[model samples]
Target: MNDITVFPTIDDIMAAHQRIQPFIHRTPILTSEAINQIAGCEIYFKCENFQKVGAFKARGAANAVMKLTEEQKVNGVATHSSGNHAAALARAASVAGIKSYIVMPSNAPEIKKKAVAGYGGEIIECEPTLIARETTLKEVVARTGAVFIPPYDYLDVIEGQATCALEMWEEGIPFDTVMAPVGGGGLLSGTALTSKYISPKTNVIAGEPEGADDASRSFKAKELIPMVGPKTIADGLLTSLGKINFEIIMEYVDDILTVSEAEIIEAMRLVYERMKIIIEPSCAVPLAALLKNKERFKGQKVGIILSGGNVDLGKLPF
Candidate 1:
C-alpha cells in the first residue's frame, strides 16, 4: 500500500502527465448546444470516453506502471477490478512489456472479462465479493511477486487522474464548476485537487447514484463510510470511496449530489441523442445530477468529466 498520509502536489501531477503522455490520449472536449440549452448552463464535456482503453483509467495505470523500478517491473503488476481499471492496467503492462495479473469477480460482465484478456492480462476469477477478490489478489501477489496497484487509493494513481482536470483547465475555459462521478473516488478527488490548486474558485462537485450513495453519505457525515449492498445500473460507481480519496474530497470538493436511476438513463439517452456519444451509465451520473439540480448551476460554465465508454452494449438500458 502507498503512504496515504502524503497527498500529491501540483509538481507531482505534472510529472505524472509527462510520464504517461505516450501511453494515453489527450481526449477532446465536446459541447452540445442542445445539452447546454436543456441544462441552462454552458457545459463542456471532457471526453475520457474516447481515451485509450476507453477510459481515464489508462492515465493512472500507465503512470503507476511507468513509475515501477526495474526490479518491480520484472516482477510485474497486479490488481483486482471488474471494470475499466483492470483492462487499463493490463494494457499498460503490455505496453511496458511487463506481465499483468487481474483478479476479477466471476460475475463480472463478459465483455469486461474479454477486454482484460484482450489486453494480455492473465485473469484470476474469484467469487463475487470484495473479500474474495482481495484474498485472491493477495494470493496471486504472494505467488508471483507482482506489485499491487490499487484502483484509486494510491498517490500516483490520484496524480495521474489529476491530469484530466489539468487538461481541461489548460484549454483556457474559466469553469465555474467541475464535476465527476464518484465510485472509488479516484477521479473525483483528483479532479478536486487540481481544481483547487489551479483555480480555487472553481467548485468541485461529485455525482453519485441514489442506489450507491456512499460518497454522498460520507461527504455529509465527514467520515469514511463503507458501501453496503449497492444496487445501481451505474456499475462503475459501485465501489466505496477510498480513504485517501475521501480525505482529499472532504478538503477540496464542494458538494456531492445523488440522482435517480431514471435520471441517469435519461441523461445518458440525451448525450447519445444530442452529442452522438456512447457513455456508460456511470459516466452519465454527473449530467444526471446537473440536470436534477439545474437551478443551482443555472447559467454557470460547468466542466463535466465523462468518465468512460466501456459499457456492455448488449446490456445497455436504452
Candidate 2:
C-alpha cells in the first residue's frame, strides 16, 4: 500500500512530473495587459483550465492512478467528488485501462456528471452532504473492492499536484508571489512546496471563498478546521482541507486570503471579458483576492494558477 503518512519530497514531485508527462498537458502561461493594468501588477495565469480534464485535478489523479501496483490496478480506483476530481479520475483510469467508480452528490452539476460518464466512469449518486458522500463511497468500495483514491489527501495525489507549480517554476519567470485557490489544499499545498523549494523568496499565498473559509481560519488558528455550512458559488471548492495538505501549507505558505462572492464573480467575469478566457468561480478566487488587495502586490510579478474552466454556461452568475 502507498504510505499516506509520508510527505512527498521534491524528488518525488520531479518523478511524478516525469511519470505523468505523457498523460497531462504542459498548460500555457497566459498574461493580459488589461488585467495587469487593473491589478497594478504583472500576473501570469498558469492555464490549467486547458488541462486534460479541464482542471489541475488531472495531474493528481493521473499520478495516483498510474502509480498503483498491478495488483491494485486490477480492481481499479474509486473516489468521491462533486465535479473536477471525479472527471479527472475517470479520465485517468480510462487512460490506464481500468475502471473508475465515482461517488458524487446527487446535486453535482450535470455538466460534470456528463464528463464523468463520457470518461466511462460509473457514477453513484448520494445525498449532498459530506457524511453522505463518505458513507456512500465506503459502501461502494466495500462492494466493488476498488482501491479508494482520495480527491486531495493522498500523498501521491499531492505529489501529482506539485507538478503544476513545478511547470510554472520551470518557465524561468521569477514571480514575487505564487497563488492558487484553497479548497482541499491539494493545489495550494503543492504550489507552496514547489515555490518554497524552487524560489524560497517567492511568497506562496492561497485565496479562498469567504463563505467557505476553513483554510483561512485553519491557517490563522494553526489547526485544521472542518468546513461547516459552506455556501459559495464556487461549487468545486466546497470541500474541507485535507490533513496532509494542511500540514504542508502551514509549513510553507505565507498567507491565506479570503474573497467575497461578488469579488469572485467579478474576477471570473474580468477573465472572461478582458482575457477572453472562461474560468469557473473557484479558479477566480486567487485573482479576486489579488484584485481586492492590489496595494499589497503593486508592481510585483504574481503567478496565479487557474484551477479549471468547467463552468455551466446556462447558469452563469454574470
Candidate 3:
C-alpha cells in the first residue's frame, strides 16, 4: 500500500489562509430551498466559480506565485494546464509583476486563452496529449529558466487549496460528509485533509468522472493508478491525480466516487434550473453522485465544493 500524508494540518492550512489572504477570494456559500428539498438534506455549495480566473485554482496559484523570492520572480514561471490553471497563473503572476509562461492544449477554450493574454501571460500552444504538454513545458522551462508550477502537485499548492475548507468551516455548520470533484486532485485532497483535521468524524469523498476514474480505482486498489486519456464532457476534471495529492487523499479521504457523463449533464441542468447557479459539468459530479446514491446522504449535512462555473451555456445539450 502506498502510505504517505502529504497535506497540511489544520494549523498549517490556517497559516496558509493567512499567507494568501490578500491574494485569494473567500468565495460564497449558496443555499437553495428547492434544491435542498430535492436532495432531502441540507446542502452548502461553496461557489468557487466566482473566484479569480473563474475557478478555485486562483487560491493555489496565487499562493504558490507569491511565495517565490524576488530574484526567482524575475525568472518567471511555467505550467501546463487545460484552462483554469493557466488563467490563474497568468492573473496571479500579473498581480505580482512576474511573467507567466503557459503551455496549453491548442484546442483549449478561446475565452480562457484570451484571459491568459489579458493578464500578460505568454502562451505556447501544444497538442492535447500529456506527453506533448509536458514536452512543450520542458522546452519553455529550459529556455526561459522559469520555474514550473504544476497544475495540482505541489505542497504549497495543496496548502493553498485547503483554505476553501477553512473558510467553509468558519460558517459554524457541521457537516457529516464533504465532497469535491477531483481533477488533478489538488482541491479534493485539500478538502479531505481539512475535513479530517477540523472535523475528524466527517467523511471526505472525491467525485471523479467515470471516464477519468483513476482516483477511485487507486483509492480502492491502494496504489497509484496510471492515468490514461480522459474521455468525458467535464473537461475540467480530466487530469490524473498527483503523487502528493494521492498520498494525502489516501490517508485522509474516506472514499472516491464516480459519475457518468449523462449524470453530470443532468446534474448541471438541475443546478442551473433549481439553484439558479451556472456550473460546469465537472462541478456537477458531486451532486450527480449524491442523487445517484441518495440513500447514503439523505439526512446528512453535506458540504460540496462547486469546483467551477465556466461551461459554455450554448453547448448545453438539454
| Range of the 10 consecutive residues with the lowest summed lDDT in candidate 3 | 1-10
- In model 2, state the lDDT of residue 159: 93
The count of backbone overlaps in candidate 2 is: 0
Positional deviation of residue 128's Cα in model 1 after best superposition, in angstroms: 2.0
Kindly give the number of clashing pairs for every candidate.
0, 0, 0
Cα displacement (Å) at residue 251, model 2: 0.1
The runs of at least 3 residues in candidate 3 whose Cα sits more than 4 Å from the true structure, single-residue gaps closed, are: 1-6
- Order of the predicted models by lDDT, top scorer first: 1, 2, 3
TM-score of 2: 0.96
lDDT of 1 by residue, 1-318 (tens): 565477888888888899999899999999999999999999999999999999999999999999999999998999999989999999999999999999999999888899999989999999998899999999999999999999999888988899999999999999999999999999998999899999999999999999999999999999999999999999899888999999999999999999999999999999999999999899999999999999999999999999999877788787
Number of the candidate with higher TM-score, 1 or 2: 1
* Candidate closest to the true structure, highest lDDT: 1
Candidate 3 TM-score over all chains jointly:
0.95
TM-score of each: 0.97, 0.96, 0.95
Q: Each prediction's Cα RMSD? A: 1.6, 1.9, 2.0
Q: Which of the two candidates, 2 or 3, achieves a greater lDDT against the reference?
A: 2
